[model samples]
Target chain A: MMFLSFVKKEFLHIFRDPRTMLITLGMPVAQIILFGFAITTEVKNVRMAVFDPSHDISTQRIISRMQASEYFDMTQVLHTADDINSAFNKGKAELVAVFSDRFDENLLRAGKASVQLIADATDPNQAAMLTAYASNIIADYRQELLREHRIPFLIEPEIQMLYNPQMKSAYNFVPGVMGLILTLICAMMTSIAIVREKEVGTMEALLVSPLRPVWIILAKVAPYFTLSIVNIISILLLSVFVLDVPVSGSMFWLAVVALMFIIVALLLGIVISSVATTQVTAMLASGMLLMMPVLLLSGMIFPIENMPVILQWISNIIPARWFITAVRKVMIEGLGVSYVAKELAILAGMAVFLIAVSVKTFKIRLS
Target chain B: MKKAIEVENLTKRFGSFTAVNAISFDVAQGEIFGFLGANGAGKTTAMRMLCGLSRPTSGKGAVAGFDMIRQPEEIKRHIGYMSQRFSLYEDLAVWENIRLFAGIYGVPEKEIAPRTDGMLARIGFESGRNTRVKELPLGWKQKLSFAVAIFHEPKIVFLDEPTGGVDPLTRRRFWEMIYDAADRGISVFVTTHYMDEAEYCNRVSIMVDGRIDALDTPKNLKQQFGVRSMDEVFHRLARENALTSNAN
Candidate 1:
């Protein structure tokens, strides 16, 4: 009963402040949309080539669709698999869309088909965006095929983004955005909300009450926890609908894993609030101590593998690194729960360790 | 009268510094017990020990019959507290603040609304129940906080320097509220450096350099110190420590 009051009070604190409400809800939508469109390497009217050996109706339809889209203008038709490499080497075409043999026959017979997109990856950003657009077109075509026919037609665009790949931006950013926003909202906001009470001296009145310290911390966490879940849902929705990122894996497992990530971030917040006496200190600590690591080291911006060996080792310990990896597997790679078991275990361990640390460190008495 | 508090040899110390040293006292039911000291005179440290906020280094204490050390949580449930600084939610309306604290203090849900009305009426703040606490005058804010503190009817309430910077008028009005709470049989454990406020307490314990050097009613303390007022009594006690520290 007392716990309910504490939760209600925290909710009031969040609701009463308009700035907090805006930052909590408005910031994520703006960021994902901005990153999806504004800070993009998206280029238009790219020269393209097709290696459609089958030249069947399915292949012709996809080729015409690719040409009709605003992003691609087909300039050549290659006849050999070997021509894909030379076409890029000779600056003949920026991309090569290679359809499999007997494309329409195989697609109708097996309800599955493949289209290999190869791109000039000398500029990884341009390469990422080109593939993202190309793949989005294919995904839309595949959706049309599913609507027209009853079979589960899997038109898997084989993304050798190592060479060329749509939502390559999606694959990279949707998870990155989730990691960044969750950290900002859960870790930073939770700590600030808690430290604000301490700064106002209300904590003394609270500590003296029958409400247990854990209950107080939980109540503080509860609101942000709910907010972050909302953020997660919205970001995922935006990714699927606006950004065209696929929820290839199980949606239920994706949500479950994301919820675990939220817990880890929220626990980090509790740990930070345990140490920070004021809101400024909490925010700076969260920024310096949590955000920097999440941004630079979580493979959110820079790939962890390409980082220096020591930095790679350090990145392994950053919670977002694990969260992004888990999300990528569950969301983009279309993997199952068992695939992300290690990441989930590590996140669960972090949650437990943080809970223990917060318990030990949270002050019961004022200095 | 039943005892609201009992303690013996309460001492709290840092590594090499003793902030509260072997101090002990008792408060009868419904009495206003003033914990008197200058700034940094160990009064807060001692009170924190009794309130179960700070663990005593070595002491025995009980708040409202609950053992302070072993059952601090139980003691917390039975006692009320107001911090040295203003502690109400500035953004929340007065009625919201009341409902929040009342609920947190485990006031029966059924009694909360009616009691909240009663509290607002008693504090003469019925019309402004919807006023955000930050907009209220600081003095009235303090009064509202005090009313809320005792709203759950805890056996004892520990207030730490509640009137630190209030004007004389507000301080007097604050004291009137304290007297009113005392009449209804709630023990008030208040800490203050104000010598004049000491005169209003049923009993006052004056601490100098971490020890309670004088514990008596204001009239008796004035008589024992051969002084005319509680201010003179305090100076007489603090002056000796001042001289000794200066000599060292």
Candidate 2:
């Protein structure tokens, strides 16, 4: 009953504060909308510089094909070798495709032609995606040419988009946004909330009460847990109804996993608050320590698989990694609850461990 | 009379710095004990140890009939704490803050609503019970904080410089509230640098350089130190120490 009242009070606090409400719900939707409309994880509108020295119908046809495709945006037509570096350096071109001289003549004689692809590897991930799109377009063109020439016995590997055939940024980001926003609002915010009490000296009043330390922590974390879950559902609903991002896995399992991770985040907030003497320290520490990891390591912005081996291992331990994986499996792949059982268990374990440690630290500090 | 709080050779050291040197004191139940010290004289540290917020590095203490080290949790339940800093929730209304403290103290839910209203009314803040604590004047906030501290009717209430920034009239009103609680058989253990406030205590103890330099009724202390008033006594002792240090 004592713990319940504290929890009630916590809810009151969260509900009363508009700033907290904005961070939890408004920010997630805002981020999802921004990332969905403004950014493309699949790499579209790539600026390309074409150098077609062949001056033949086939070269022009290829350039037309490239321009017509949504993947490539023809920004420049370079005539000289010196122009290549300047085009790339000016950021006007991501890919420089050179059609060698006599390229159309060779296609008619030996029925073979080569195109040189020089890509800016500065943003390797973008470069890689752009390269894949270019390769597919070239492959399609080659197939058309072979069919026109009455070629036979040709083998081509069929490309299959295993998941997210539409490849919308919303599908890729909604789940990650949910995880990041929930952690920031639930864990980071709640941790600082308690420290605020301490700073204002209200903690002494609470401590003098018969309210147990564990109960106080529970009260502080409980409201955030509820608020974050509400945020999760709202985001999920928006993703499905508004954005048309499909849930590939069990919605029930997805919710369960999400809740598990949220609990872990809330517990982490409690631990942070227990250690921090002031609200400023709590906010600073949680923001720097939790937000960055959730943003980078959770595979929200960057692919975890392509990261260096050490960073890969580091990301493995991050709670956001499991959450992102679980959310993606459910939201993108529509995987069942059974499929994400391991991740859910890991999240639950982390939550329990963090809560236990927080309780212990609180007791030690109080004593 | 039962001893509400007792400290024997209590010492608290942080790293190499002795915040509270070996000190011993006792307060009977229902007494108003004023703790006086210059800044950094370990008054807060000693009060913390007695309140069980901090542990004594050496020696022993009991607070509210429980061993400070062995049963701090029990002691915590039986005592209330208010710091020089206003301790109520700024965003919460006066009544809400009272109810929160009451709820934390495990006041029966059925009793919380009435108790909250009663506390507000008793503090003459019933009209502004719904007003946010931050919206209230400093004097009212201090009064609300004091009322919230003893919401559970704890055996002892600890106040660390509870009236630091208030005017004399407001401080006097705050003292009246303290006396009211003491009149109800609640022991008041308070720390302050205010010499005028020190004079109102049934007994006062002054701390200097981590040790108690004087302990007695304010009149006795003034007379023994050969000073005109409590303030002069404190200044004389502190100045004498400075002169001795310079000579050394």
Candidate 3:
């Protein structure tokens, strides 16, 4: 009964502060929409400079083909090789497609053509992706030409992009956003809430009360738990309805995994609050320690396999890595619980370990 | 007379230094016991031990018939604590704050409504019951914190410099509330750095360098120290400790 009132007070604290309410409920929606539409991995409308020295039917045909594709915005046509350097340097183009000065007579006699793609590799990931996209478009055009001219020596490889046929970044980001948002709201908010009580001196009153210290922690965490659930639902709704990300597996399993991750995050928050003496320390610890790991090392924005070996080893310990993997398996791949059993078990173990450590630390600090 | 608080050589040490050194005292039921000391004099440390918030390194104490160490939870149930920093949720409405304490202290559901209404009327701010605590003046917040601390009607209430930073009039009104609680047989264990406030207690103890140098009625302590007021009594006792330490 006392615990119930404490929970009610927690709710009152959350509702009375409009800023906390806005962050808890509104942040996830904003982040999902922002990341879905604005921050995308799929390259679109990439400005290209075409150095078509040949100026023949074949080069014009290839330039028109690149223009027709959504990926390349073929706006600049360079006359000299010197223009390639200036065009790239002036930021007028990200890619310069240089075609050799060859007449149609050479292609007809030798049945061969050479094209060079020069891309600015400042952002290596985007540079690699843009070059691959341009090459793929050129390869498509070659296949069509070969089919028309009955040149049977070239072997064409049929590539199928399974799971995400159109390769929508939303498919990848929605689950990652769900993981990131849940961990942030659950861990950061709960730690800040508890630390605020300590800063305001109400924690001393709470400790003096008949309410058990563990119950005090639970009371502090109860509201954020509910808010995190609401956040999960909001993210899911926004991803599914607005972003058009599909949920192929059972919603029940997805919720179960999400709940486990939320519990893990809340336990982490408790551990942070137990160590932090002030609200600023708690906020910094949560933001710097927890948020950075979840964002960078958890395979949220970057793939874990492609990272350095040491970093990949470090990513294994981040709870969000396991969570994002499980969520993608369940939500995007439409896999069942059996497929993600290892991840679920790891998350459950982490939650238990964090809870035990936090409880021990809290008790030591209280007395 | 029944004793409300009994401390026998209660000591607390942090590593090599003693914060509270062999402090012993007692207060009778319904008595206002003033715990007075300068900054870092260990008064708060001793009060914390009696309030069951800290463990004493040596000796024993009891509050409201519960052993400080073994029955800390029972002692917590029977005592209330208010710090100089007002311990109310500023975001909560007045009535909500009151109800929260009442509920946490296990006040029965049947009596909570009447008790809350009575408290609002006593504070004479029935209109402000719905106002957020942060919106109220600091004086009002301190008073409300005291009221909430004792809302469960604990047998003893502990106030650690509860009147610090308040105006003289507000402190006077706060003492009136303290007197009212004592008159109703609630033992008040209050700590204050203000010597003038010490004169209002039924009995006062002055601590110097973690030791209680004097424990007597304010009038008797003044006479014992050959002083006219509690201020002189405190200064003489503190100076004696300084002279002794200098001699050592």
The TM-scores that each candidate's chain B achieves against the reference are 0.97, 0.95, 0.97
Q: Weakest 10 consecutive residues, lDDT, candidate 3 chain A?
A: A155-164
Deviating ranges (above 4 Å) for candidate 2: A37-46, A51-55, A61-73, A76-90, A94-170, A275-277, A307-317, A334-364, B13-18, B240-248
> Which scores greater on lDDT, model 1 or model 3?
1
DockQ of candidate 1, scored on C-alphas against the true complex (2 decimals): 0.49
Candidate 3 has which clashing residue pairs, if any? none
Report the error of model 3 at residue A353, Å: 3.0
Off by over 4 Å in 3: A39-168
Interface Cα RMSD, each model:
1.9, 2.2, 0.9
| Candidate 3 CAPRI classification by DockQ | high
Pairwise TM-score winner, candidates 2 and 3:
3
Q: Once superposed on the true structure, which residue ranges of model 1 sit more than 4 Å away at CA? A: A40-125, A128-167, A363-367, B246-248
Ranking by lDDT: 1, 3, 2
Q: Which tens-of-lDDT digit does each residue in A1-367 have in candidate 3?
A: 7899999999988887898888888889888988776654678999998887788887787788889989999879998889988997689998888877673444656666677778765444456677788778778877787788876323222222212233334477777888788878888889999999988999999988999998999998998998888888888888889888878999999999999999999999989988898989998998988889888888777666667999999998889899999999999999989999999999999998997899789878866
Interface RMSD of 2: 2.2
The ten-residue window of minimal lDDT in model 2 chain A covers: A155-164
The 10 consecutive residues of candidate 2 chain B with the worst lDDT sum are B98-107
**Tens digits of per-residue lDDT for model 2 on B1-248?**
88999989999998999999999999989899998888888887787778766778999988888998899778878888888888787878877777777876767888888887787778777799789888988988888888988988998899888998989999999999999999999999888877889888999888888989888988898889887788998888788778987999
